[model samples]
Target: MAQGDMRDRPRHAGAGDRQMTALDPRAMRLANAETVLRALYGADALSQAAIATATGLSRRTVELILVDLEAEGWVRVRSTEPHASGRGRPARQYAFRSEVGVVLGIDIAHDRSTVAAADLRGRTLHTAVVPMPGEPERAERLAGTRRAVAEALRAVGVRPGQVGSVSVATPGNVNDKGAVDVELSMHGWTGVRLAEEFAPDFAVPVHVENNAKLAVLAELWEGATPGADHLLWLMLEGQYNGMGIVMDGVPYRGVDGAAGEIFWAKGLGLDALTASPLIGLGRLEPEERRAEATAILERAERGDPAALSEVDSFADVLARGLSALSWVFAPRYVVLGGWLAWALGDLLATRVAARMARNAPPFVAVRRSTLGPDAVVRGAIRAALDRYEWTAARPLAPERRPSPVDGG
Candidate 1:
């Protein structure tokens, strides 16, 4: 277990203060209730006193919240169990209901998009893929994506109105202003206002994030590195690269939102690699490219020197980029994920790790992603579920009232 080091504490306030500040009174109560429910959902069953202790809420407050949640069909009481110590009477236990409304996650990749739906308990119910048109106009591409997402939701018996929220993961830097700036991979996507584009039609909150950042969130939520603080997610695919940083279990999107665009590393002069050889080859249709890359991998595995050289060069460029990222962020672990990541396999990961060990500090460990290409979509679902919890718990404030019609 990697114990969280107090020395890595962010300059910002502690988690308690941050949580309280992010939510209003009603929202706070709702978030607290959701936290308790999640704990019970994970643990299967827990006494109200145990939940209170785990969530830092009073026992009475936990009881009241559980009652409200039960009324909403979001929680239920399980059979009571005796304490092992036998110091007191048997205590009632609670668990989350798994039949609540669904949430959707959309991962928009360079050449494809995946949409998945899951219930409140994070079990995937449905999934679909839409191949991205080759360098189509932006408006046309977005419209196609909207249609694909709606169709996938319908396929899973999830109506548009029934969807609580939608989370989208795109390749690039997403800022607090909700503007996504992607100059490298996702050309023509700079300054795209994600909320304004997707909110009106869906009539629900939409969270748009960088693909790498969302991958990190997925790992933190359900992957191999669960509960890990100070982690980095590196997505290696074609000419596009992305990075997501988590410090102390919280994502850190730096000022201006361009935190992990390390492809622009000044020392390695990686701009050239993004040109003809790699980008030109990757521009082929995804199927065509996948076939070609896989064939090369098979040949390399058979000891073809030429194929081995190609893989080595690709790994070298990737390692250089990772080294630059490590120098700046210095996360405890680095996760590699994306389409091309499959081709790299364990050897590529090991080579990257070796390079990092030789070039960078000794604190970081490199690991391959367990979720693979599905990570972004899973992370998106997690974000949507969080939004649903927030919205369901607290309705927006009512509009200000005007004076009476007849009276002054």
Candidate 2:
């Protein structure tokens, strides 16, 4: 837990062209709902005719879909005068509702777990963290995560049932069963069923994602590099080293959701560095280990000979590993994150960038994470928030409005 850090489609169908009557009711309903949603999403507000033009549906059909969306609390209907004027009655416009409910974000890490309760629009209502036990089992970790979630909700005076969705970010890989396949070498963490841990208790959908990947999500959503299609997120906490890939603004989870497990790049993360003779760095006490990295970085910053030596050694290894990865993926931007990024700071970034510059042509930029330690958890929150967006963006059933009467 670093600390709280700073901020920052559709087919067209004509009304009387015979396509409407030939279309299936279910699909037409879904398509109309989508058109209405697109009209609202694409604009601040859209009248039925505006939506009709954008969707190629009749104004009455747009009205029917608007009724359904409003009924489901997905849109807010407002009566306003048409821009063209000459209307005896105000025309109705629709706007997407942003505050339908809240989503839960949980970050379960090697040291601690945090839970954040936020509105659908990604506004944080409350958040809390619980320290993980020195030795935790499947049940204990789940219990701890649940406690944090409960506390977060309670802090905000919300109920479990009110949560629309949940996303969990952890140090391990998410397996098919929704359990995180934590590296066996990790301390106090192993076979943990992240989905079962929360799913049984909460009716909302539960999503388990790698912390680094989640951090990448956070960055892609809001960070220094926004909307970069090709990105590489490197998570280098002393305990773990991995990469998260975002292809075209979407996470590239492999067939088994292990695409970011780049730690195996030339056996760098096959096992803890303790197993490697070159590094010769063994796992110290959690506090000592964390402090040691910070101290080494501090000394390096001051140009200490020994600290500089160690930093150079680590940088060599990282450069080699990153170079190998870059040769393959060739990401546009590589964002350094996790505790190691915080400890090493710009020194590490510059070092890595210099090494990567050797690759030539299509140089991948190296930058420090703006979200800091909260990146992964915030990304989890983002995952939860995405559910709301997806659900709302989807098509829904709508009533078929009566045909308009033509005045000859």
Scored by lDDT, the top model is 1
lDDT of each: 0.69, 0.68
Give candidate 1 regions above 4 Å deviation: 1-39, 52-64, 79-92, 183-188, 271-292, 394-408
lDDT of 2: 0.68
lDDT of 1 by residue, 45-77 (tens): 788988898778898889899888778666678
Candidate 2 per-residue C-alpha lDDT over 113-210 given as tens digits, one digit per residue, 9 for 90 to 100? 79887754566767788897576765677778788988887765556766677898887777766776756544545676767767777767688887
Q: In order, how many clashes per candidate?
A: 0, 0
Candidate 2 residues lying further than 4 Å off, grouped into runs, are 1-27, 38-57, 77-93, 185-189, 268-285, 302-309, 389-408
**TM-scores vs. true structure, each candidate:** 0.78, 0.77
For model 1, the local distance difference test gives: 0.69
Give candidate 2's TM-score: 0.77
